[model samples]
Target: MKSMMMLMLLLFLMPVQAGTPISEYENLLITEVVVTPTDAEMIEIHNKGGVTLDLTDVYLTDATFSNGNVYYYQVVSGAGGGGDFNDFFARFPNGASIAPGAYQTISINGSDNFFSTYGVNPTYELFEDGAGADTVDDMVEATPGSIDDDPGGTVAGVSALSGGEVAVLFYWDGNSDLVQDIDYVVWGDKREAVDKTGISIDGPDADAITSVYLDDTVIASQAVINASSHAGGNSWQRGNLNEGNETGSNGNGVNGDDETSEDLNNTFFEGLPTPNAAAGAPPAPNLIINEVDAVSSGGEFVEIYGSANTSADNLSLVFYDGDTDQVYQVIDLTGSSTDSNGFLLVGNTGLSPDVTIADDSLQDGADAVALYNIDASAFIVGDPVTVNDIMDALVYDSGQADDAGLLTLINPGQSQIDEGSNGNAANESMARCPNASGGSLNTSTYQAVDPTPGVLNSLCPLGDYYATADDTNATTLRNTLHEIIDDHIVFPYSAGTTDTWDVLSFADEDPNDSNLVWMIYKNNSYTWKGGGQQAYNREHTWPQSYGFSSGSLGDDNAARTDAHHLMLSDVTYNGNRGNLYFDDCNAGCTELTTDVNNGVGGGSGTYPGNSNWFDGDSFEVWNFRKGDIARAMFYMDLRYAGDVSGEVDLQLTDNPGDIQTGQPFMGLLSVLIDWHNGDPVDSIEQIRNERVYSYQGNRNPFIDHPEWVECIFVQGGACTTVGDDLIFASDFD
Candidate 1:
């Protein structure tokens, strides 16, 4: 959210072209400063003008500090301590000029080490001050390439590094006289001035006071480096130069232009200090904990890829399990690395032997994995890791929230890491859609895909079904509904056994009732699917006899085998349901399935179903199970709604010829739709929806979105008014 606001501000302030006229003061913009220990006083300047400007008469002066003493030092080149500004900056002989789009430094000799770090040669190095200074007012200047003795004075040097208000001024004198100022940048709040609250640079004035600064726009946009909030590593500059982190049209400007003010946002740098170097220098990492295969049966693995060509060396990928609440594992990546785009960090090489791997730490369902800057070997269970240590953290799960219920992040320090959340499910990984150029990890940026460890994230299978909706009525969404499901793997059915037993445990795992299995179809209660004596079988909620192929044991028998619908029903009740359509089995006919008298009990006679509305040809479902039954039936009907030559071959209609060798159809459409709306999705149905999605690589669209029923089956208003045109919003609205 903060990044968004920054982007808006950047756009609002970005100049259309780099042709704006730059005042002399705007040309030499102050970007960085260090004033502490009395011995180390420095400032970095950026040249933002169109062409090089001579600095012959430029002066680095003070606007009276707490002592109220006016002092000035000439800005020149080379090492110096006396003459003009050997204590500040030296002048560049006679015809000297700063090149356009350049940087210059104004510092004392004590800060040479800091300037050396970024390889920025200073404009002038202050001459040695020997031991200490004892004065309230004094001034020093030197000629090019010379360090002269400090001229003793009663006045002292600039104030110490404590948080006080100070403004660095850069003004030019047209002639030899030091009065008529051409341009100046009055940075920091000058405490010695009359008004100490607001900025004096943009104040109302004429040629009096310190009013000859730059244009109103420059005054309004000068990025004032806040001394109070300044930290050791933090520098004031553009966070992302490519993304327009600078101001003004000139390439030299790092923080301010005529478009924005040196407000709090612009003042100081965004990261660690780089003294003489350009502000906002060094871009953030574009590396992402790209993908993870936590639920992969093939073994767990995590992949890290860089959208940009960043070295992968010295980085450590850390894993933290919420169950343990500590750093469970740490993979210390070695070598002069970093160009690790296709790097796969897998544990137990046997898991993905054919692929490239560096290291491990297994991740299962509902887990958290964090990538850190260095090794976390000392971190163990219960020990809280420094949030700063974690570069990027991701939670691989389908649950709406993390185990701890904390929202995940999608960037790093001030920052650039990612943590995926919501709409992300099992059997697939969370990957950035357009690779790495993203800022958030919500439903849009992260996509679920089949585990593609060690490969370009986008190379994985498309998410035919990772995302599911609940209250959708969009025709466009309904039209592409089938696209959300992928059929890479499917489980076939048996008389009593199938992947159902294993998958169902997770789908409806209940320990107390004979192992973690939701058995003996009823509503919300678990008994047993039975054993030796007599047992219930996998009941096709949408029975096979009514037009679905009874599993040939191979794929393609979705109606008979899809786990989303198959449930545990009494064996005797199973034989009784046969190929009956769902309706009010009231008239004189054989009844089956839905009540005790439906012939389901430990000891049962061949007493035909009396209460379970079954009229020989059609069956009636219990009220509690209506919505569940309706969803499964719709799932089977639409899942296999593959184009039949040109039209949908399978549909839920009243008449669907004799069992086999006949077109597929179911009946009591009005009743089913009523049942669907009346019951809504319950706790059990929702559990089943999640479980089926976890196992079958797809979910019952109706279960996820019960509203799809009317949108799909009504004719004109019921959503199935018998024509395609009537199925969409445009038809009626």
Candidate 2:
């Protein structure tokens, strides 16, 4: 027999087949790298991976130029974008991984200039000053196969060389003086010593500028010197190209007739004669026109940018009616194809001209740019959404079904529950909001998360126990519990033995596991703290739904004994348990079993709780087997039935789920039938029965010492006080 038992136990303990590990690469990719005219010697590294890549150790270098040692740089973990300072360069704000195949652009400007012009022969560079021109000259490969445009396609040089209009890159030299200076000349015309549109000599106070001409017609330009605009000695220029805007009737040898009256076809960045130290915090997302594909009655194809270098990612923009305060839609602009000025080139589907027109030329949508301000009271660290608001939004945006798109943005756990999945969020939340006191559901019974001992993820320790002194009411309750447990309840330790349940201490080895800890819930979070002291809130076993009136449960004749249906419970569990009757299986039946000895030998006969009265129709006594049923039924009796007149019908229950009401008790009782072969004991149950004894306190002698079998029903079967008298006095009868 022992061998068979051991074999069965071993078989039960054997491990089940393991399931496949979840792959992180299951999500869909969203943003891709967008290339356009405004690329401007810049490149974005999109997160095309399944998870956020830690870019801290990731290397970025320029290896295209003839010079092997061009430039090198590194991206710090959280320093890149979205107003966050410590992110993995490979990742973004909120730990969101750049979606698989998504682009994460790294600009070759400001602090990131090294990657722009690191390796190049005839080298690629940004020339702030040219002796022959007044404006900064951006060297380009006017002739194909030129030196300035040569990328050598090297790992250290430019990533690409322009076939018709090559480009040059620049960086702030870190000179606090704000003085602009000539950096370097990268000639790409295949000519080692070309004229290169060099800046001409400048007179005192005259700004020297370089101008490009095709058939004596200027098109693009950049500035080089700090000369007055009127006395332009040096002016900046785009590549050395001169395309006539349009040949006018008075056209001279010059395609357009007048040099100063030429059409501005090309683009240029005019360096202010004096740098404006106070540049309005570059417009939230300094967008620029990157490209313009097409423009017609149809929508336009434009791209916008949200870079990590800028503080723009923190913004939440909405499209609204220009005339009315009506809001349209919110957009995630961080990945929009845009230029440095926050304008999509035009014609991008995201920025279609038709959509723009429909929205009133972008001006209307501009009015919708209101901030989604955070409400301090509603805010939680991991999520920005409020419960009710999120629920409404989900209903509106996703229809009756769960919206995977919206869920993608919310915490996965919350999303699951919101979608009606039996995830832990709802359960956890309900379990954490119970009343602290073992009895009473009142304002004074409220408990909160403990603030001191400040363990972020762990529960409050016993020494720092807040409920003990949060208020006079809580203190009294604590005292009462101590007295009751010491006197009536027999703790394993109090019985001259070591307490088996010593897991309540924060010092427990598995402090992180809430299940292993006592006096706390499943999250390692405190069940109750002093009122308003921490994250916890007191829970009530007997809901105050019936009324808030309070009095002793046994005080049947008392006028104010209406609100006696309250007991402490975990906060989060309370929500999950919700409000319901305990009679889950059958009315008035509990799962509790009586000892065989008590049932047959008549030892200590009657069941606990005076609330259990003899009912000849069915059974002699009532007992709540399921803990939840007892709690819920108690709540209903004390709150609802006690306050208002109603049929006090018994409920049927089967242990369907964690109970918070009466009906479920009957179900639990059935479930425990197989295991019941001995005496049943529950301290709280004993107290309840004692209190309800004859609707009187301990002063009632008859209630204290009555016929043992008068009204008793043991686990084995039913018993009746009337039957017992007849059986005992059979001869007399």
Candidate 3:
């Protein structure tokens, strides 16, 4: 019943307006007025009236007192006009006009001597049902049902008890249309938590002032009655107040729902103990390219790639050696477009690949080898490869083979003659240098020999063969193939939409040239397949194996999880990536096997791969594309893996033993090594199952941009594409 009554009352009071009158002689309705300290030196007057009223001639007065005498003081010397819901006091200018009806206010610092001269004995009255400080009968004895009743009967009426002290009565008229608005009030040592209590009855007759009391004892005869003019009190209005703690809101009449000045703070903060305090700097991108080798004896360049995810002004790249004492240039990347947290940090190039690499065997100053296409001839024919050399190819060089004997065409064997020191051997007819027929072919473009200066040089030379061979016929054939899959490569899709494609005929019998993907928008359908994987298969460019999910898309979900699962995969070879996210989970074996046979099987009549690796231990089986898995996994890890200390509190290790024990997917490393060695498939079948791409789409971005892949390939002797001639010649060797 109380709740219902309060609800109804709230509804009724929601629309009530202050009933201040417009007459020149009418009294100003005072609203809320409060002083900060109990012994505040100055007083403030607040008017809660409904309309504009003049206070210029109106004076605040205080009744004074002596041993046996009483007095009063008129506080203001000049008359000032006050506006509706506003205020005017002796010290400060006018504020919001007093409204049309009930109001409450407070006053302080006015003269006390004048009250003694006017026969007004000052008293600190703690009122029960009250409105403003000016009312004579505003004080009442503590009542059982009154809203102002506190835990203790600490209420009292005005009666002078000591010098340097004063008090005033507050009243709320029962018949007034407006309830009094109280912020808080204080005078001398007396304080009250205001309740807008009032009488419901109307009367033209004056109400007698309640008897003055001292120390809980009533001095009935000393009580003074007030009707027309009350003294020592003033009223004012509340102006702009903001909605947060320690911060003031501005603008007129802008009150917070609660005392937000004592509450609420920064909305974005989490894990914070106090209001208005920040935790620390946000998480940064995890990228560490420890050492970059250009495989050249001359100076080489290296790049560290990742999003800074801060304002351009805050984007800085610092480079240092192992000791941290040797530092490189500090590059300011303030204007990069990839600074947007959502966009891929891109085009932030680093070193060129033309730098020379020194052989470990040769003396420090002996002849150095230059890196052209990731192959280093500085070392002996079969010297054990260095982690540094592999990282160099991964970080700075690309398009080189990962085998024992074949000389590299791009970074040729160390011989002056066209014939290699090893032999002229397995050189495949060169693919056109630019692959002009395919507008966006990946293997065609030159790698970024130097990124800081933004220069791209041609990859493998077309050589004199271009003038000797049927160049026109070859280009026409390549063009025809490009035309077949022209529209399938696009990027940047609207969120929450799927791109669909259909398998079609290809030039030659290239399986990668068959299928295409497209996005539907409005009435027209567009193909935005991007590169690599789009031309290959619906490869989870972000490997589905590492908890990557197709259904989740945002940073909070798919991008978050899949971001960790990136790697290159053959569309056909990815049969190994089966339905299993991770092969170690034992509880969901049946489900894993089923999912692999269904979604990832690619509807190929034959099961994805039936190698011994796929035997009965469901959790032990992996579904990666063995034919192309090594480079893919390397790319995936390079794309997403960063300094993860911030997110999962995990650490990264370069130790090979960690991949077999300390790491979660240690077993997969061996599988990848075997796949890279072509152990999963025989020579002919390995070549047949390889996934080729135009280098469009997120899946094949590294292959499309070998410069970026150089950072990774150099660290591991992993190769993605092999020249047919190189493979055949190595077989003969």
* Reference-based TM-score of each model: 0.36, 0.17, 0.22
Full ranking by TM-score: 1, 3, 2
Residues 462-534, model 3: lDDT tens digits: 2222122121332332233223322322211111111111111111122232232211000111133433244
Q: Cα lDDT of all candidates, in order?
A: 0.47, 0.24, 0.25
Ranking by lDDT: 1, 3, 2
What overall lDDT, based on C-alpha atoms, would model 3 receive against the true structure?
A: 0.25
Which 10 successive residues of model 3 have the least lDDT summed? 219-228
Give the clash count for each candidate: 52, 165, 113
lDDT of 1 by residue, 108-181 (tens): 44334334544554565443333553221112343332234334532223342233333334333432212222
Which regions of candidate 1 fall more than 4 Å away from where they truly are?
1-478, 486-488, 494-498, 508-516, 519-534, 546-556, 589-611, 644-648, 656-661, 718-733
Q: In model 2, which runs have C-alpha deviations exceeding 4 angstroms?
A: 1-565, 579-679, 684-717, 722-733
Return the TM-score for candidate 2, rounded to 2 decimals: 0.17
lDDT of 2 by residue, 622-645 (tens): 242233223323223222222223
